[model samples]
Target: MNRQNKISPFLIIVACGLVLLYLHGCTRVRPLPGPAKPPTKAPAKKTEKPRPYKVMGKWYQPLPHARGFKQKGIASWYGKKFHGRKTSNGEIYNMYGVTAAHKTLPLGTYVRVRNLKNNKKIDVRINDRGPFVRGRIIDLSYGAAKKMGIVGAGTAPVEVTALGRPMAGKSAAATVPAYMPVDFYSGNFTIQVGAFSNPDNAEKLKRKLSRIYKNAHVVNDLHEKTAPFKVRVGACSTLDQAAKYETRLIQNGFPDAFIIAE
Candidate 1:
């Protein structure tokens, strides 16, 4: 045994410590920042606004002197499919009868319809609402077109004249009718100079009333339980004008003259 070959226990322990240090250096784990912070809530999205429709054209009524009341467009007739159905006026639709549909005009309105191509004319009651398709002005029932001699062509050039009154069954002899009364909500009012039991009497009074007022019209209240016929004059824009007319009516033999707000 040589003295150089002999090793002390403390020297062996020192060698083991150096080996452990080398292993730790080879397998070192890098220090990482704290776990990633959860993403902060994002701000809420903004809301959107609504859009409006484009109006193609303005609406108007064919005036009394609008002789060229002619509007050229597609004319269509509704038939059996719509028969027996309730019209916009709440009346049962009879396609076999002479009736028509109009937009804007009041339900139960009366209109004089003429087929320009055939020179045929007919009185049609507007019981429903329509001709909703763009460019078309009136929708006539099957019977109405046949009366106007337009069924053969299916569609024809036409002219429409608004009647002086509503379309319900009361005869022209009744009191004045309100075609398009000034809205009562607007505080507009009118007065009747006379009430007639006969249409001829009403017509005579109408002529006289027409001379005094620009908006004079005849109206029939078919829905009324009594006094079905009534004639109304001047849709005064103000209560004072209506009262003035009422005074004139009283002086002219309508002793019971009263104001009618429409």
Candidate 2:
């Protein structure tokens, strides 16, 4: 019995040792992995383009003294091509006259034009719109260019200076009244409204005010750097009407609305 007991204990120990070896073989251990890396990318490049030349957007600021403002550029002339045509201001154009075309200066605005090639200068009134194309600065009437010696040159470099008032010796100064304020009427009473841009906006405002006031209308106000369609609401025939509308406009917005008599 003693011998059997000893053998049994030995066999049991051998079986446990085999079981431990089997467990160690079956439970495999994977090697610890290193951290993964992120992806790399390439950089990109940029390209640029060239711009065109233009002058319409440049000379668009109001001058302190119309006489003080001056500019240099190519000048040309027009004749029978534009004769008898209605100007932007509704005035008839007489190409033989000494009137001049400016990009934006007010109609009736007088400017001193100098032909750089001949050194001859003449004062001309801005009576029409033009030099509508690019590269040219001023467009003079047939007689204006002839007097300034630009007709012979075809196109000449010139300097233009605003005269504030009227041309001293031009026909516009002699025949056409200088600085005549446009008449605005409120019934029998007349008031002048300043210029505005966006004629449709003016028309819209005109209709809105017309519903409330009798003398509402739109007027063309032309000036250098600005051509506006102004909405004149109500022709106040009396100070009372003007005063009443002025108060109403202030209450309805447009706190700056007022009346200027002609």
Candidate 3:
């Protein structure tokens, strides 16, 4: 009719170009499915808290007041050279456990050790700190100094009397104390490397161990109101010259030195 009206406009322009290529393949833009992968965050769990620690230039400080803490002095033992190691609260040192070591008590605090020259009592637990030398005050754990006979007098004249917290799964020798009353005190000899509730940090570790220790003093414990200064370093008159300056202050780093007959 005009060629069938030009073939009806070329079949209506090929059905409007196949409906615009099927509406451009249903509005194709398919690049939006690549942003849904962000869910991975879980790693945070560490809580250990129990601070304050320094060994040779001394800084201690770990006492949440282990109730009724008593004391007398001089008692030492620590077999097999610190047996299976790792103590001072991280346990593991089982020199035949009954455990003990207290520069400022409170690791587990369970003392009773009364070998005041043979009244022999035993029940230890403290866990570790030391007899950093200076009138020694408890360290035993070669099986509590061989059950308080003081392992053949390596040192004894004990008395430490704090029996505060320890019951669950008992057996610090079941809190032994059938009888324990012996008290005597006589002191001389020093090497205590540090103790302080800040007397200028015990005179800044008694002026840095009095420049290589000759007598680095600082003693002042009018009965501690929290660590009462102390810091001593020498004055050995014997106890084998304070055990040869506590084995040269524990080979010069003072791994908790010893020999404090004062």
Query: Which candidate number maximizes lDDT?
Result: 3
* 1-262: candidate 1 lDDT, tens digit per residue: 6667779899999999999999999999989889999999999986321111112342222111211122445567888889999987798988898889875454555667877777787777777777767778899999988887777777777887666354356574445543432121234566654455666776776777788667777777555445445677778766557668878877877665566655
Identify the runs in model 2 with alpha carbons over 4 angstroms from their true place: 1-67, 167-262
Residue range with the least summed lDDT across 10 consecutive positions in model 1: 60-69
Query: lDDT scores for all predictions?
Result: 0.65, 0.66, 0.70
TM-scores for every candidate against the unseen true structure: 0.40, 0.42, 0.25
Question: Which regions of candidate 3 fall more than 4 Å away from where they truly are?
Answer: 1-11, 14-18, 21-23, 27-29, 35-192, 199-201, 206-210, 213-247, 250-262
For every candidate in turn, the CA RMSD to the true structure comes to 22.2, 22.6, 15.5
Listed per model in order, the count of residue pairs whose N, CA or C atoms clash below 3 Å is 14, 5, 3
Error of 2 at 76 (Å): 0.4
Per-residue accuracy of model 3 over 49-123 as CA lDDT, tens digit each = 234466766555444344445768788888898799898678789898787888755577666788877697867
Q: Candidate 1 at 154: error in angstroms? A: 1.7
Q: Counting only residues 3 or more apart in sequence or on different chains, how many pairs clash (N, Cα, C under 3 Å) in candidate 3?
A: 3
52-152 in candidate 2: lDDT tens per residue? 11245432211112334567999999988779989766888888788888765656677779888889988887877678667888999998988887787
Positional deviation of 168 in candidate 2, in angstroms?
14
Error of model 1, residue 122, in angstroms: 0.5
Record all residue pairs in model 2 with backbone atoms less than 3 Å apart, i.e. clashing: 104-224, 105-224, 106-224, 186-235, 196-228
